[model samples]
Target: MSVPPRLSMATLPSAAGAGMRAPRIDPAALDIGIVHLGIGAFHRAHQAVYTEDALAAAGESDWGICGVTQRSAHVRDQLVPQDGLYTVLQRGTGAREPRLVGSVRQVLATTEDDVVARLADPAVRVVTLTVTEKGYRLDRHGEPDLRDAGVRADLAGHAGAGHRPRTVVGTLVSALARRRAGHGRGLSLVSCDNLPGNGSVLRKLVTGFCAALPAPGGEDLAAWVAREVSFPSTVVDRMVPTTRSGDRDEIARTFGVTDAAVVVAEPFRQWVVQDDFAAGRPAWDRAGALLTADVTPYEAVKLRLLNAAHSLLAYTGALAGHETIAAAVADPELAAAAAALMVHDASPTLRPPAGLELSGYCDAVLRRFANPALGHRTLQVAADGSLKLPIRVLGTVRDRLAAGTEPTWAALAVAAWMVLLVRGRTDDDRVLAVEDPMLGHLRTQLGRLCDRPRPHDAARIVAVLLGVTEIFGDDLPAHPVFRDLLTAHVARLLTPTPRRPSRSAGS
Candidate 1:
C-alpha cells in the first residue's frame, strides 16, 4: 500500500481549498500545558475538539496538549507527519462537516523518555486520560493488581532500570515520581473513561502502586501525590467510530489534503466534569463542558441508560443480522427492544441529575444511535464483553432486582451475548471472532459445555456462563430471580424457529 502524502504545517497556507477547515489559532504560538494519555479516535473527536474550542474561546495559547499514546505507535505514526494537526469529520444525516483541531502541540509514544519529562514539567498543570477500562490494570476488586507482571516490575523499581513502563498504572507512577523529584508542582489528573468513579478509582490504583513500591522515598511520593494531585472524574459522551482507510481516503479527496489522523464522529458531544481540579484548568465550560460540583448523577444516567442500551443493541443487533448501529436500531423490533431496555430495565435504577428528563434522554440516545452517517459498527461495540458487561448491563440487573423489579430486557441482552458466544456467528451468518481479554478462557469454558451430553440445553449453557465469576459476580449466579429469568431468555433464544422463505422462492 502506498503512503498518502503528508499533511504538515508547511502545506497549511496553500491547503485551504473548498474542503479544508483550517484552525483559527496559530499552532506555533501555543504552549504545552496539558498532557493527554491515549491519543485515540475518541479523544480526538471528543476532548481534543473541546480543548481546541476552549482555547479559542479563552483566547489563550498556554493550554496546548501533549498527546501520549500508551501502548502503540499507531497514533504517533499518523499524527507526527501531520504536525499534530488533524481533521474531525462530523457526520450526521446531512453532509459531513470537517474541522481542523490544533490543540495537540506534540505527540509522543510511551517509549520516549520525553514522556516522563513532559509529565513532570511545571508548565503541564493537568493530565487527562482516555485509557479504556482494562488500561487501569485493576483487579476484579478494583485495586491495583500488583500480581500483574508489569505492575510488579514497576513497583520493584525496574522503571529506573532503563526499561519503559509497561502499564498505564506503572507509567503514571513513574511520571509522578519524576514530578516529585523535580518541581513537585501540583497537577490535576482527570479520567474521561466510562468507568464509575473513574477519578477515585485511578487515585486508589496510583496510591496503591506507590504504597507497594520497594524503592526509597515511596511513602513520601504517595504523601505528595495525596496532597498535590487531584483526580477529577468526568463523563464524556460521543460516538467516534474507529477510522477506516476509506475515511482517510474520503478526507484526502474532499479536503485536497492527506490527513492520516482524520477521525469521524457524530455531531453530538458532551462533557460533565467534577469541579475538583487542584490546579487551574482550561475554560472547558466556555466550550459547553458542564463543570459540576458532582458528576455522579450525570455519570449514572449515561452509564446505566445510554451505555447499557448501546451494549444491548450491540449484542442483540449483531445477532439480529444488522451490521451498523443505525441499521440495527432501524429495525422496529430491535429499536423497540432497546427502548424497553432503557425505559423499563435501566431507567428505574438511575438517579439522573436534577431537571434532567429521563424519557427525553432516552429518546435522544436512540436518535444518536440511529444516525446512519456515523457508521458505528456493531462488532466494534460488541467486543470486550467480559470487561463491559459488569458495568454496563449487570449493574442495572442487580439494582433492578434489589428494587423488586424484573430486568427482563437486561437479561435478554446478557442471554444474547451467551448465544453469540455459542453460535460464533450473527443471525445473518456473519462470523464473529471473540475479542475479549478472556477470549481464551471463555472458549475453554464454552468448549467444556459443548462436551456435555445436552450441549444445546439453555439451562446448562446459562449456568456455565454465569459461573464465570469474573464477568458475573458469585452472588448474581445464586440469585434465583436473576438466574431463572436469564435462563428463560437464553432458552427462548436457543429454541429453533422456522426459517423464512428465500426471496427467489416460487420464481
Candidate 2:
C-alpha cells in the first residue's frame, strides 16, 4: 500500500477529496498583506478562517497571510511543504466538510529577515498575533518586563545592522523603527491574545519598549509610535483541539491527501475586534466578525463565564481522571460546579454585554465544551495556569472581592490548579503532567513537598503559590478569606478519591 501525495496546488486538483472545498481565490496570485505572529493551531482554525471568508465575500485577495512561527520552525515545516494549504475540519453541528484554507500564502521562521521586511512593508498594513500570554514577556503589572535579559539584550542589539532581536516585542519595535524610516505609513498592530484590554496592553508594551531606548532616540520613537500605530484589542472565541495522528490518518484515507497541518475545530467561531485601525483592515465584519468601538463588554462576558469556567473544568476534570472536556463537564458534580461558577460567581462580576442573555450564554458555553467530537483535552486547557488563570478567572475574583464577597467557585478553580501543581497526580494515581512557565518557581517555593505529596501541607501550598505576586498580586495572598478558601479546597482536592466508573469522551 502506497501513501497519497502531500496536499498542495498540484495534488489538490487531482486528489479525490470527498466534499472538499478549496479557497475561492487563486492563492498564488494573492499578494501578502497581513503578517501573523505565533502561527499556532488556534490562529489557523479561527482568524485564518475569518480572513478567507472576508477575502471570498469581498472578492479581494490582498489580505493573504504570511505566518511567522515565533517559538520554532515546526509550523513553517508543516505549512511550507504543502504551499500553505491545510485542511480545517469543523467537527460539530452544521459543520461544512473539510476545506483547504489558502489564506496563509507563506510561512516563515522568526529568524528569517523576511518577517522584519514584511512588517516594514507598506503593502502590509496589519500585524496580528495569537502568541499565547507568556509571549508578551510581561511583568506582574501587565507591563513589559525590562528586567528580562532577553528584553535588555534585544533593546541593545536592535540598533545594529542585520540584528534579529530574540523577543516578540523586540522584533515589533525594531520593525516599527524601520517602518518609520521607510514608509512613514500608519499600521494596525492587533493583539488577538486572551487579555483584557489587550490592545492597550500591547500599546503599553510597544511604547514602554520605545521609552527603554536610550534618550533622544527613545523619545523620538515614542512620538512616532503615538502617531503611526493602532493597537486594537480583540475577543476571539473558538475551541480547536490538538490534532491527533488518527485525525491526519483519517484525512489521508477520506480526502486522499497527506496533510501535516490539519486542524479540528468546533463549528462555532467568533471574533469581536476593537475598531481602531490606523490603516484599513479586512472586511471581517462581512464574515460574522464584530468590528466595534469597544470590545470590553464582549471580552468580559467571554472571559468570566466561558474562559473562567473552562479553567475550573480543566483542573477539576483532569484531577477526576477525565481525559476530555466533554467527559469533565458530563460529571454531575463538575457540571453543577461549572454552572454555579458561571452564573453565581463570574456573571455577577461582569457588566453584561448587550443582547447577550446571561443564562443562555452560560448554557451555550457548557454545550460547546460538551462537544465530544471536538475532544478538547482537560490537560490541554489546564496548561499554563500561571498565565491563563490571571486573564480568565482572577479578574472575576478581584471584582467579587471588590463587591465585598468571597469568590468560592473561583477559589475552588484556583485551588484545583494549586493541587495540580503541588500534588502532581490524578485521584486514581495517574501522573498528570504539569506544564506551566512558572513550574520552576512553583517547585522552588513548594520545596520538598513536590516529592512527597500531602493534604496537610495545603495551608503552606496556598500561602506560597499566592505569594508569587505575578499571578495573584499582594492583595489576594493577604486576603484572609481568599487564603482560607484556597487552603480548604486544596486540602480537599489533595485527599485520596475512590475510583469511579469510567466515562468515555462521548459520554
Candidate 3:
C-alpha cells in the first residue's frame, strides 16, 4: 500500500471526479467575512456545508469562514495542512457522493492573537459558534459562571490587564471590546449550539460577563454590545457522529486522497435561524436554511421533540449496552420509549412550528436516529446529561406536570441517566462512559446506592438525585407525583431483568 496524496487546494481539482462534488466556488476569490469559533466536525459537517452551498447558490464571495479551533490544535493542524479543505461523506444517501468543501479559507488557534484580530476586523460581520453546552460556563440560570476558573482568568485579562483571555465568553467579551475600539461596526453573533433560547442566553451571558467586569469599563462595553450586537437563536439538526478512521479510509479509497478532517454525516440536515442579524449576512435560506423572525417556536419544537428523544435513547441505550443510537432505536422497548417521549410527553408541551405536522416530525426524528451509517454513540449523546436534560427533557417534564399529567417517558429518561450515574455499566458488564460536569455532585448524592444495595433503596436514591436543585430546581422535588414516578422508574431500571416500560399513572 502506498501513501495517498494529501487533500489540498492544489490537489482539490483532481480529488473531485466520480462519486464526488468539487468546490463549486473558487476558494481564492472569497473573503473572510465570517469567523467561526469552534471548527470541530459538527461545524464542518453542518454550518460550513451550509455556507458553502449558500456561496454557490447565491454567488456570494464575501462570507468565507476563518475557522478557529477552541480546544486543541488538532483541527487547526489537519485543516491548515490541507489548506482548509475537507471532505463531507454524506452517508445514508445511497448515492455516496462526498463533497469537498472549500468555504473555510483558513484556520486559527484560540491562543493566536490573530483570532482577536480577526474578530475585530470590520469585514467580519458575523461570528458563529458551535461550542457545546459546557463551553458556555453557564450557571443553572443560564448566566455566566463568574467563579469559573476560565471565566475568572479571562476576566482578569480583560481590557489589557496582562492576561490572555481564556474562556469563550471572556474571549468574546475581550474581542468585542477591541471591536468597540476599532471599526465600531454592528455584528451578528449566531449561536449554532443546541442551547435553549441560545440567542437570548448568549446575550445574558455577555451582559453577565460585562457586569462582572471592573466597574465603568464593563458598563461602557455592555452598553455598546447592547446597541451594536445581535445574538440570534437557531435550531440546528444534523446527525454527525465522530469521524472514525474507517470514514477516512473510505474517503481515501473513493476520492483517492487523504483527508484527516473528513466529516461523516447523515443526509438529513435542517437549520432554522432567527433573521435578526446586526449586519449583512449570508443567504442561508437559499441553501435550505429556514431564516425567520422568531426561532422560539422552532427551537421549542426541536428541543422537546428531537433532542428530548435523543437524550432519552442515549441513556437507556448505554444502559442496555447498545453502542450506537441506531442500535438503541432497534430495541423494541427503547424505541417505544423514545417515540413516547416525543409523541406522548414532549409534543403536548410544544406548538408545532408553522407548517410542521407533529406526527410526521416525530416519525422523521426517530427515522433519523435509526440510520446505522451515522454511528452516533450513545455515550457521546449521554455525556453532559446535567446540561442537556434541562434543555431537552426537563422542560417537557415541567410542562406535563403542570398540565396535570404524568410525564412517564421523560421521567424514565431521567431515571436512565441516574441509573447510568450510579451503576456506570450495563447488565452485560460493558462500561458505560457517561461524562458530566456535575458528575461528582451526582455521585456524592447517589453514593447511598453503595450503602444500601437492597432493592427497596430506590426511594432514597431518587430523593438525593432529585434534590439536585441545579438540575431539578426547587419545584420538581416537591411534587409527590413526579417523585413517585421517578422512584418507580429507577427501581425497575435497577433490576437485572430489563422489561418494557409500563405507562405512567396518568396521561
RMSD of each: 3.2, 1.3, 3.7
Best by TM-score: 2
Candidate 1 C-alpha lDDT tens digits along 1-507? 555466778777655665587886889899999999998999999988898889899999999999999878889999988899998888886544678888899999986646877887899999999989888888888888867887777777545757677788788888888888787788999999989999999999988888887656778889999999999999999999877788888877766678889899888889999999888999999999999989999998898889988988888777766778887788777789889999999888888788999999999999999887777888788888888888888989998889998899999889888877777675545577656777777768877654322324888888888999978987899988988887888777666555332111011
Quote the lDDT for 333 in model 3.
85
Q: For residues 206-286, write the lDDT of model 2, one tens digit per residue.
A: 998898889998889889999889999999999999999988998899878999999999999999999899989999999
lDDT, residue 70, model 1: 84
Best of the two (1, 2) by lDDT:
2
**Model 2 whole-model lDDT (C-alpha atoms):** 0.89
lDDT of the structure predicted as candidate 3: 0.87
Arrange candidates by TM-score, descending. 2, 3, 1
Q: Candidate 3 — number of clashing residue pairs? A: 0
Between the candidate structures 1 and 2, which one is better when assessed by TM-score? 2
Where is model 3 more than 4 Å wrong at Cα? 93-96, 448-454, 498-507
| TM-score of each prediction | 0.94, 0.98, 0.96
The candidate 3 region of ten consecutive residues with least summed lDDT is 498-507
**341-401 in candidate 3: lDDT tens per residue?**
9999988888876688998999988888888877888888999999898889898999899
lDDT of each: 0.83, 0.89, 0.87
Q: Give the runs in model 1 whose Cα sits over 4 Å from its true position.
A: 1-5, 94-96, 112-114, 450-456, 498-507
In model 2, state the lDDT of residue 74. 91
